[model samples]
Structures are given as structure tokens and as C-alpha cells.
Target: MQAGSPNTRQSSSPASKGGSARRRTPRSRNRAPQSPSAPKPSLFDQVGVTAVDPAPFDQLGLPKALVGELTKAGLTEAFPIQAATIPDALAGSDVLGRARTGSGKTLAFGLPMLADLHGTSARPLHPRALVLVPTRELATQVTDSLKPMAKALGLYVREIVGGMSFARQADMLRRGVDLVVATPGRLNDHVRQGTCVLSAVERTALDEADQMADMGFLPQIRELLNHVPAGGQRLLFSATLDGDVDRLVREYMSDPVVHSLTPSAASVDSMDHHQLDIAAEDKHDVLARIAARDGRTILFVRTKHNADRLTRKLRSVGVHAGALHGGKAQNARTRILEEFRRGSTTALVATNVAARGIHVDDVSLVVHVEPPADPKDYLHRAGRTARAGATGTVVTLVTDDQRRAFRAMAGKAGVKPTATKVSPQGANLARLTGAREPSGVAVVEPKAETNRNPGSGGTRRGNPRGRTGAPRNGGGPRGEAKRGEAKRGARRA
Candidate 1:
């Protein structure tokens, strides 16, 4: 969730559209017909596979630096959304992309931003590309995605969000930035304060447009766009484009090229869904067993307290799980996310916090330990799985009492999860899940202390440069002195 937002939007899950029944193919009866010694297809035959058809960078005419950065980050291959939208985005034309979350939308817009932006000796703090996200974590994550590519292109990216120190964000802006990834509310704050200007913005992207509308940010989003030039390129990407999002597209985008990957409701069809019936008393044990069999698992609960409590229970049972909810401090939220991304934590026991904007690779499963109130929440929760075309599993742990609500959520999301009884130890979890023991557990040694500091760079020792710590003798640190002196020194120079 974005920080300081009072009213949370109920999710619009696809289950109500009646697609769930098709996904509940039982494991026992799911075996395919045996082929008589037919040869398997080569790597090239796979669509959306690692085999390259036309690279996004190549087709989009992006700078070599951006492609190099993506290659270094193991993203040489483009997802379908990236391939479909990059060409138009790079061509400086408006684009409307319909793709589910985790479909590589960041790069679809980011690559072109890096390519088209012209850096100056007098760097403009004003953004060349403005990416409006729905959540603060997403702002940070999108900024992270832009950083390497920006650095490779000798550009700078800034993050503007709420809950973080405004002074810090202002300082980043003062230093000058090439691109800005921001949430609507905070971005509006900066705009109203004159800390940011959109006059120079040549490209703008509204990611998760449906979610933003659902969150009631459409007015703020429109207010933001009012500051940008009408002639500038606009890109809107979302899972479903209805209501306000469609209006935004019509109002802002001009002759935009449209790319829809699939029907939004069917996006999760590639994912495996399961409904586990576990006794209330055995819930913790079954969750631990399922979490233990994972690559990375995101477990969802209904309440902030449950999110925190379950996190501890998972940890006590020897599963590395972290908690995320609105109750956590910003620093703690960032740390838990870093732990999950770095593989230090195999599972994240979260409320609706991870429902959006937290992206890590190889997240193979999502478990809804508690049913959400509505279908939109279910869609956002289920969106955690089946990311970037990677197959994943979503299991909802439902007791008899919660069956009706679970069924309702499933119906709205159009997913029929396989129903099974989970024994106390999750005896049937492995077979039902088709998950082998997580690969790194054997090779990864346990650490004595948990490295939960986000700025620590996943190291036991805090920031190697000691930037995150206070200065000695109530004085500024080395970098701080230089930073403080730069403005003064520049005037003299």
C-alpha cells in the first residue's frame, strides 16, 4: 500500500467471471497422454521462453547502455509486454498496454526513457520521464530497475514517495535527476511545492492504472498530468482498463498503439491454484511445511496482527519468514523486502502489503492463509504468483468456516483451486505442489544474526562507506562534509 493512504480499495478479483472452474484440474487426473518417443521441441520453439525472437532494445532502438545493463541483470530476453510496447514507446508515440502485474512493464517504459533522455552539463532535476505508480514500494522498486540502466547511460533516477523523509527526497531532486518514479500523492506534494516540474517531461507512464483508479488516485493522477505538456508521449499499462483508466487513456493518450497480451481474467490461468483444508490448530504446521517446500513464498493474512504473529511462528518453526503490513515502520518494511529478495527469507507472511509493488525474481508460490474481504484483494494477492511468465502456485488455507468466503473470492478471480486436505505436517504438500525441496537450503548456511537493514546491502556490517551511521563527535561524516561543502564550494569555484 502507499503510505498514509486512509481508505484501502477492495480488490476486483476475476473469480466472479466464472473462470476458476477451469483451473482446478486435479493432480491425480492431470497426467497428459504419453507420446510414443516423439522428440521434444528445441529451446527456440518455446514462445515467451528465454530464446530471443526480437529483443526489446533492438526493436525499440534503445541505447546500447540500456541493453547492456539489462543483459548484466539477466534480463536480455523481453517479456511479451516489453516486446509489444517498447517499439512505440521508443518511437515517442503514446502507448496503451494491457498486461497483468509482473509482466516486465518497468523495462517497457524505462528503456526508452534512458535512450531518449538527453543529459546536460547543467543537469535538470526536472524529470524527462515520469512514472506514476500506485504504491511507495513500487516507486522504490521501479527506481531500482531504472538505477542500473540509468548509471549505464550516465543518467540519474530519483524516487519520490510518502512515508519517507521529504528532506531526503528533496535533496535527491536538488542533485538533479533524469527520471522520476513516484506515487501520485507524494509526486503531487513535490509538484505543488515546486520541488519538481514536468515542463521538460517527454515521456510519462502510468503503471497499474486499474489499481491506481481503484485506490481513488485518478483525480490526483489527472492533476499531475495537467502540469505536463499535452504533446508529450503517454504510456498507460494495466491488467484491466475499465472505468477511470479507460477515461484517462482517452483523455491523455493520443492515437496510442494498443497492446493487450491476454484477457485480464485469464492471466492467472498459467498458474497452479490449490485450496488446502487444514484444521485451525494445524494451520501453522501446514503453512511451515508448504513454505519449506518453496522457492519463495508470499503468505497472506487478513489482519496486521495476524501478519506479525504468523511471521514469528514461521520463524520459530525454522522457516525464514518476515512480516509486512501497514503497522511496520518504513525502515522495517524496506528491510523485510530486502531479506525476501536476497533469499535470506524464504517466505514473507504479509497482510495486503505484498499484494502490489514488491517484485522479486523466482517467487514460486503465494499462500492466502486468510481469505480477504473481496475479489480485488484476491486478484492483487494472486498477482504475486505467475510473474514474468514463470509458473507459480497459489494456495489458500481455508477452514470449513471460511469456505464460503474463499469460494466467493475464487469465483470472482475466475480460479478454481484444487481442493485437498493438508495433514498436520503437510505430508501431501510436496506431491500436491510439485515442488522439490528449495535448492539453496543445503548450500546456504544459516547466519547467526538476521541482516534486516535495507541500507546494509545485505551485509552484516552496515554500509561499507558508513554513510548510514551518524557522524563522530556530533560532526558530519566524510561524505557528508563533502556533500555539505559542494554547494558552498561550487559558488566559490
Candidate 2:
């Protein structure tokens, strides 16, 4: 008998000890057993509860002004996630949204929050709505996505994140912002400094909550959420929900309506996964050949140093490559992303910093130089390409030693890759990346002086050797003697 079965439990009861157990007839025992019933679908699959068919945004009851803004931007229909969550969110219900990255989640939450706060007055230093993201890039992207709609509603939105001037953020807070999009760390900094307050916030949204939990930001997230009024509306969205995310739901949200457009660990249907086994020595050449292709590619590395090193190597082979990581300054990071977007830099080498929030159009390929440590990381890294209905290729290069680990990672990530052993010059490689031979000539690195002083060629007019000469530390022996005499005169006095 199956353990814990009702029949087994009943057989063990004292009532069965009165000779009743032996009274079973052979005919009854031979009777046909009943067939088991089919299992019920999970809550996530019960779309009839909250899922709505895709329709025009007008049917979702969005304000005319907001719809006008979306119309101007040529967004007429709603995505699945938007269609599923917008109605409930607009009705002031706490929402738990489960959808992958690049699924129009920004608008899923942004529109309702804006609509709710539309005409409501915000006090200085206290915003009526808050959207917390895990990275500065995400904060910027969310702001860009919502700014136009917020402006149409006459609501001001400001971004608060680290790696930028805090004073400017404080000034914006001081001047009063209706909505604030921020990373948890920077928001906590402002909160502790008393430059911003959340008492007035009536709506709060957490995008990519799973990533925040993975990055150990849950404590900070909890603390920030605590600042909002206890009864304020809360919306949490993530690609996967578990661990600290569950704790968050229990502690903060009150009977939230959960909506999931995809399975908890669903992989993108438009992305093609491949595993290329190549010799270690030929990896760089293979990467170079792939990166030199005509379209945009993002190469994921394990560390910031590796990102920089690979970018330099790719550029040395005459590929227009840029590096992105936490090590870069905010403006430099922004510039690199802009260049990538505008096709000035066709290839980008980056750490996982770009995995979650960096969205660029027509990214044709994603190369994993090092396999991600976790399945979620793999999904996010692969998500950079094949976004929003676009088909793309994801290749993970596995050396002999890494083959086992790569296989395990792929298994955990629910990916069935097309594996092949390839050489740097293999025809498969060429076909996979639209490969082309890289320019043999090394790219010239511009001199620092030329960048610092555009036309000044490492020289300045104040130099004692003249305009075309190198700068002198001290004018000469006389200049040194004058400095020494001045020090002696001060001591003697």
C-alpha cells in the first residue's frame, strides 16, 4: 500500500483488529480498482482567474491622457502581462506579477501607479509612488520608459541611484518629485540622510524582485518597504518567486492577487541555445570571429576584469567593442550603452550587470565566455538577446574541463542545447554567428593627452620648454630655489 494512503491508515486503526481485517472476500479484492483522477492545474496555470485576452489599451480603462501618450508612442495593444495585471492594478489591488524580462512589465506597473497619482498632490521630499529596481541601469531604463507618460499626467518623475551625484538627487527630492524610481541602496542612503521620505507614498512596486533577492538586497528591500505606510498598495514582479521573495510577500503584501504570464522557470521560446566545445587555445579566435560579424553581440564574462580584458582583445582585432561593468563610472557606462544602441559599438563585453536591465534593440547574438554560476543568471544573460519577439542565438563555449559543469548548468536551466565540437575555423561557427574574418590590423588606442586636451598633444603653453614641449614640474633650478627661499624665510620669521 502507498504510504499515507487512506486505506493503509484505516487498516491500522483499532476497529480493523476485531477480525474485520480478515473478513475481506476474494471477490471484493479481485474487483477492478478505480482509476486516479487527473491532477489539477497549478495556480499559475489557472489563467481563467485573472488572465484577460489581449486587447487594446483602451479596454483596460487607462486614463485618456495616458492612452494618448501610449498611442503617440505607437503602442496600441497590450502585452499579456499588461493585459493580465493592469485592470487589477488600476483597481487598487495589491498585485504579484510573474513574467520574464522584456515583457512590458515597466508599463504593467507604471501606468496604474501614474493613473492613481494623477492629480494627487505630492509633498516636498515625499513621492506618492516608488519603483525600486536592483541596478542603476534598470532605474534609468524604467525612468525613460515612464517619463513620457508621467509628463502627460503632469507628474514629475526622478531617478535616485548610486554612482551619480547625490546632491543632485537631494535637490530633486527637495524640489518635490511625484514619483521616484531608485535602486534600494541609493534610496536607503537618501532615507538615512533624511533627504527623502516615504510616508506620503501610496503605491510601491518592485521590479525583478528575484534578482534583488539573489543579489542579497532583500534586507535593504525590506527596510525600504517598511518606510511606506503599512496600508499602501504594494506590487511585486519577478521572473521567479521563492526564498526571500516569499518572505517579502508574507511580511509586506496583504492578500495580493498573483498573476503569472509564463511558468516560473520558463525559457524564452525565441532564443536558440547552443553549446560549442572548442580547444582552450582557439577560444579567443573563435570569439573574435563571431564578434566581428555584421550585427550586434553581447559577450558575458565572469568578472569585471575579464570584461575589460576581452573588450580590449576584441578591439585589438579591429572589432568595435565596449566594456560594461560596475567598475565604470555612471556617465561612461551610459555612453557605452548609448553607443551600443546607436550601432557605433556593435559588440559589448559585460559582466552580469547588463544581464537584467540593459535592453537594446536587435541584439543578434549573446556569447557566454564563462557559464553562469546559477540557472537564473543564465536566463538573464540569455535574455539580453531574443527580446520581445525577436529571434536570436545564445552560444556557450565549453572547454573540455568545463563541459561537465556546463552540462549541469544547462540542465538546471531547463535548456536542451545543440552541442557540437567546433574549431576556430569550423563552418558551424561561421554559420552560427554569421561569422566574418576580423581585420588583421590592430586598432590604434588614442593617446590620453589627446583625449584630455583635444588638440594639445601632451603639451601646454605654461610649460617652460614652450608650447610644443612637455610640461615641467618646476620651472627650473631658479624656480626651485625661489620655493626653497620662501620656506626658509617663513621658518626664520
Candidate 3:
């Protein structure tokens, strides 16, 4: 979710120089020819490259009301994944779709659900369709995508997730609901409490099913399923089908039609990946300048504390940076995401919380403030940009100490970014970033190890002096949340 309801039209456009959905392709023809000196695609260019079939939704028989809503919302063409999967889903078959992040998976299933579901008044109040996602951000995102179509059909959809009032959710359920988009944990909680019932659900979807299993939400997912009858429609869309996720197909779904579009780790072809080799001293300065650039930039940090600290540091230096992470209160996350979407905050510092399922158009830059742990994470992080056939940039900042791990991530991600040195305030950086003058932030080195506090998670004799910095707002790095914490939050799933 890009921080606001779908009803908010202005929220659809990003602060980046990239124009509205309509202005995008048509305006491409008006651009000046690229000079021969322009940087060519690096090895990373071919990593996520695949020829996607961009077709209109009418080919899939999407109802007119939904089509009209999409047209009014500015999505005139169906994304590749949407074009591939919508037909089967609309036909009421159990559809299994495989598409990477940013390939528009939300509508791949949502459109069919909206078209098939009867309104709340006709359906007798309980959910007729259920969308189960791995994260709260995703639950909110999927809900946002379905909202307009649901309203057009005179149906009601509620987002049930953790950190919100369960009583409020119960109240909403009591009032009546046609569709429920939820994280498995919270929905299971409702199921356990008898506050919400899935017995009436006719269509069920597990969006990002692979992630649900990876985040260890399979137990709750299974428990949630126990509340719904086994014969209902099942639609599972994921980047891949394996392990417990594959078992879900065996156990839960009937004879399903699978649609696999791109391989996992498919970074968009149009994205440019650059690896900057900088000393620890100059990394922050380079990052601050990048964030202050003209377009929407998403910087990924390793820990929540670092995310908060970096946001504060960027703000102090006059960059409008906002932090997004799991530890944030739901409303705070909402506000931060809203600010970013509205262009009031052009730079968003986040962890994996914004990685999957969340869609914010025209994110022209994705900066890995800290290295991702694996290729999948790298793909998910980079997928935030270069969406819908638009060009974007992915930069990884690696200091000397992190070189080996960075290389490992590169090899795993199958993206070999060209190494280069970035001056703190150089014309090269400005040209790529669309900024003319240097930002005011100064480059600073990591302070030397010192016994600042004997009580502060005492350091080892020779290793780094501090515990790994947390992400901004006292959270650890973006993707550094422990498996246990992700699991607990998976309860909210």
C-alpha cells in the first residue's frame, strides 16, 4: 500500500519526474535521443529481463464496471502477469500464478474476485472472498487494490490485520463484509475467537504464498484455512511454488491451472544496477546526496535503528527522508508512507516491510544502504523500482568490510554491477541523480571503537565495538528482523 486509499487519485502519482500513467509511454517519444556517452546496461541489465506481454484486460473478459474503474484509475493496459492469469481466474478456475514482485499480481486475482463476488446485502454479511497475504503492508495494499471494484459492485471489504483494534474488526464483521483482505495471523485470531467466519467464503487467494511459507506463517495459514470449507475456490499466486507452498497446492487446491510468467529473481530489464566502492567514511554522504535527488528514492537499511538514524540524519542535512519498518505503529507507517507518496517526503528509508506486495509507482531509484542477505531479497528490494516497463536505478553501497558479503549477494542475485567510486559531491553523481548542486551533508567515517559505555552490550576484544546498529527508530536493519519476530508478526499475517 502506498499509504492511502485507492479513492485518493492524487496519491496515484509519484513525486518523481516520471509523469502519470498516461503521460508515461506517449511522452517517451518526445524525449531527446540518448547520447553515445550515456551509460549502457551492465550485466545486471539482463538479470531480471524477460519479454512481458502487455495486453488490455478486455482480452480477459473483466466486467465493464471493473474495466471502467481501472481506466478511470489510469491503468489502461493489463500488466504481463495480469494478462496471463486474469482469464483463468475470471473463469472461476483455481489459478496458480507465478510472477515476480512489481509485476502487478494484485489485480491478477483481485479483478476476478470482485467480478465474481455478490454484494454484502446479497451474500448475507460474512466474507464471500478472502485474500491472505504475508505482511500487514501487503494486506493493506491488496485491500487498496480491491476497494474501488468492491465499491463499484456495492460490496464491502475490510482489512483485518494486527496493531488495529480487534473489536473494531469484529464490529465491521458484525455489520457485514463481502471480501476480507488479511494477514493470516490476525485472521486466524479472528477465526479462533469466532469474531469472523470464513464458512461463507467462495473465493480464497493466497497472495505471495511463497513468502507466507518463508516467513513461517504456514501454520497460521493452515489454521486459518481450517475455518473455511475445503471446496471453495482457491487461487495461489507466488514467485515460486515449493516446500510447504507446493504442499498447499497438493492439499488445499483442486485441479488448478498454473501460470508462471517469470523466474524467481527476475529483476526488471530496464533497471540499471551500480555498485559503488566507497570507504566507510564517505558512504553516508553519497547516500544523502542520492536521496536528495529529484525523483522518488527508496533506501534500504540493514537495521531498524539505522533506518531511523539515517532518516534523522538525512532530514538534518535537508533531505526529506522518511523511515518505514515493522516496529512502527500502524498509523505511523501509514503516515510515513503517505508522506512519501504525496511528495512531501521524497525519500523513503525502509526494511523488507516495504519490499513485497507494496506498490508505489515511479520509484525511480532503489538504493541498498546496506547489502541484502540473498538474491531473493536483492530482487525484492530492486523490484521496488523499474516497474511497468519504466526505467529505474538500483545502487548498492558497499564498504571495504562488507565487500565479501556484497559479492556473495551479487552472485546470489545473479547481477554483476559495475564497480565505481562516487565522489561525495560530483558531477557524475549529479548527472545520474538529476540534481545540480551538491547536498549539504558531509561525509563522515565510522567512529573508532571506544569504551563509550561499559554497560552497552559490551564489545568483544577485537571485533566491532557496538552491537549491529538497529534500523532507524530503534529497529534493526530493514531485512534484519529475527526469524522469530517475523514469525510473531506472521501471527498478524
Candidate 4:
């Protein structure tokens, strides 16, 4: 689940609830032949059902204990996507779903997967279920969402992603885990090094398949999935189904049940779209004012450098702002997000990395500090706001030279934004974003917290082995040869 919208998160879950299924043990990645029982679809096709109505949690086939957990969490009803997909998924069908982020797609797949995994136990290093996400942030969020439900079913879940301790993750897998949430790159690294095994994966889900394809993780995804036996339950959920995602369906998924909540490239209907025409010189002032506005606001910049620069400028004027980008260490990224969520940091300036998997409440404004180049990008950035039925304002600061291109992209995005020419402290700017002059007193930015632990990804301790956990000479036949050479040199000396 991509943790769609906050309301979606609190609302969507399995209607019947998850229940345990039979367990099977298989060794070797692709070594065992696929079960003959797997359905083979002669044609790549999708079955759409329009009569999907919301169902209560207790009726959808989930285990009783798991349903209790959902009720405890106040998620007693299934959302549209969950309502559409859960019954088929519980029936062991390969599911292909398309819905925007914040549509509560996480539990739509998660609850049923947990139910099926409940009776099964994993062997050391082999998870019974696998979830491949595009980013570490999304991986963490999915793990969090599934934990309470999984606990009710007596299943264990762990995450494998970069910017975390590689050795610790391997140790957890070795001990045993039921489900593993991971990113493609880090999971592949584990698979190659024999730290994790996918042969036992009876159910696999690909969250955000489109972004994974966009990020060029298709080959690695294929390599990972190849380890799972054929005829296993596979669910693929994406914002869109195109080129690579469709290819994945044809090649990997059997006849799948397709559920689409919105049209492709759909824009959020509740967002107030606006375009501010400003000179390059005036952007800084207008941005500062916007940052100082009431409530949580996120400003999207184009680069990591700009995010940091904008954060600094906002803080210099007494705005509690945090900068987020992929360049920051994992710990830093986590801390910044936590602060924003806790309301200690009201303004977040980030790159495209924050567009997906960041679900927070009362985020009333989303500003495109630098407009995205494409309609897809625009939709994703705008998705950061106006989620789950809450109205939000999305403003893109467009310069004169960029006006034509921005308008064209917006049109392609199915948007006809209100256009205005504004400057620093102008009433138009104030009315649009509730802009007000900042306090103009410098507030020192908080330094990123440091972790002294040896393998938490940011810093290392005094140890012979490092993040990779490989030996000094590399720990193989080559290392032994080098040791022999060193001994011989010592004798000569």
C-alpha cells in the first residue's frame, strides 16, 4: 500500500478481513518447477467490476483477530479500491489495480495478503510474502501499516532497504520473517549476497510499479520475482498501467483482476489550482511570505540544492522549515519528516522524492517553487495535497519565460488554473496563499541528529568490518591468497 491519503488510510481495509492459508516450503530460486495448478492466461486481459460498494471489515474473509485490530484502529470499512479488489484478491486471483496515492491501496492488498500468510510460517531467510516498493520511505510506511494487522494474525514482517543496517536486516531474515518489505536495489543486493531468499514467496505485491519502471528498476524487479514460483498470487498496484507495467502484467501476472479508481493522469478535483506570474527577483520574497503562512505547507523545488537553499532562506526569516531530498542520509530524512509530522516544522521544502508516500493531515497548501516539466510530474506534486476529500490549494510559481510551457503542461493535466501576476507583499499573493511578511529574525536550523550505532547507514563505528560486512581483504579465495602473500613477505623481511 502507498499509504494513499490520510482519510483513506483511516477508512480502507479488508471487508471480510484476512485469514491464514496453507503453507509450502520450496528451496532454490527458480529451481523448483512452478505448480501445475497456476492459471495461465492466453491473452493479456483485465476484468473490471463497476458494482463495487464499500463493505464492513468483518464480512470480507479476514481472520477474526485481524478484523479486531482494524476496528481498534478505527478502520472498519473498505474504501473504493479495497472494496473493488479485496474479494478477488482473497480468492487467490492475480490483481492489477490503478489508483492515485492516498486512495488507501495499502490495506487493500495488505489485509488480504496477511490473511493468506497467517497460517504459513517462513523458513529462515525466506519470507512467505514479498512487497517491492520504489523508495525506502514508502517501504517504511507500508511496513508500519501492516504491522498491527500482521501481529493479530501472528505473523512477522520486516523491511529491507538502503540507508539502514545491511547486517542487521540479514540477521533478522536469518532468524525468520513472514513478510518482507523492500526496495528493488537493496533487496537485490541482499539476494545476491545470500542474505535473503525469495523461493518461498507464495504471494508478491508490487506497489508503485509505474514509478519503479520510471526509475529503471524493471530488470532488478524481474530478477527478484523470478525467484518466486509460478502460479503464486501476485498483485500489482500502480498509478498508471503503461509500457513497462503492462509488460510486467503480461509476462508475470496470470489473468488479473483490474480495479481503477480514477482515470489515467487524473488530477485531484478538490485542489484549488493557481499560477502566479512572478519575476525571478520577486520569487524569493513571495516564497518567504508563503512559507510564513498558517498551517502546514509543502513547497516543491527541482533540485536538492534548491531545497536546501530555500530552507535556509525561510529559516533565516524565522520560519521553521525543513529540507528533504534523496541526497540526505536516511536518518536525516527520517528526522526531517518526523519533525514536519509533529508540527515542530510547519514548512517542508523538498524535491520530487516527497511527492509519493508522504501522507500527513491538514497539509492545506502545496506550492510548486519550480514547476514540473511534465503533466505526470505536475499531477504527482499536486497529489501531495487535496487528498481524501479535503480541499487544498496548489500554486505554481511561473516566470515569464516558463509561462507558455507551464500552461501547456497544465492543460495536458486537465487543469485550467487561475492565473495572476503578483509581487512581494501584494494583496493578490496575500489573498491567494494567506501570505504575510515573515518575522525577519534568523532561527538557527537544527542540525541533523547523529546515530552512534555501527550500521544505521549514516555513520560507522570502530570496527574492522564496515557497512557491507565484508572482510578486510574481501573474505574469499582472493583474500586467502593475499594473506599467504603477506606471510611470505614477512618471512623475507
**lDDT per model, in order?**
0.66, 0.75, 0.69, 0.76
Which has the higher TM-score value, candidate number 2 or candidate number 3?
Answer: 2
| lDDT of candidate 3 at residue 346, scale 0 to 100 | 87
Best by lDDT: 4
Model 1, 1-493: lDDT tens digits are 0110001111211122121111211122322444779753211121122211344444445666677777788777777767666655665556676667787888877876677774542144577778998777888899988888888878888887654555566667778777888888767766766667887776788988888877778888989888987777787887775657767865776655566665657667878888888789877667767777657888899876787677666666567778776544456678778989999888888876578667778888888888776777788888887777778888888898998888877888888888998775445767775433322233232233222222222111232221334422232122322432342121100
Cα lDDT tens digits, model 3, 106-162, are 888888777776433634337778999988888888888789888887888789886
**Per-prediction RMSD in angstroms?**
15.6, 16.3, 14.3, 10.0
Error of 4 at 445 (Å): 2.0
Supply candidate 2's per-residue lDDT for 77.
99
Q: Predict model 3's lDDT versus the native.
A: 0.69
Q: Which stretches of candidate 4 lie over 4 Å from their true place?
A: 1-51, 448-453, 456-493
Tens digits of per-residue lDDT for model 2, 123-200: 889988999898888899999999999999999998987656566677788889999998887678678777799998
Summing lDDT over every window of 10 consecutive residues in candidate 1, give the lowest-scoring window. 1-10
In angstroms, give how far residue 361 of model 1 lies from its true place: 1.7
RMSD of model 1 against the true structure: 15.6
Over all chains combined, what TM-score does candidate 2 have? 0.81
Against the correct fold, how does model 3 do in TM-score? Answer: 0.78
Q: Which prediction has more favorable TM-score, 1 or 4? A: 4
Stretches of candidate 1 exceeding 4 Å from the true structure: 1-56, 119-125, 292-294, 433-493
Candidate order, lDDT descending: 4, 2, 3, 1
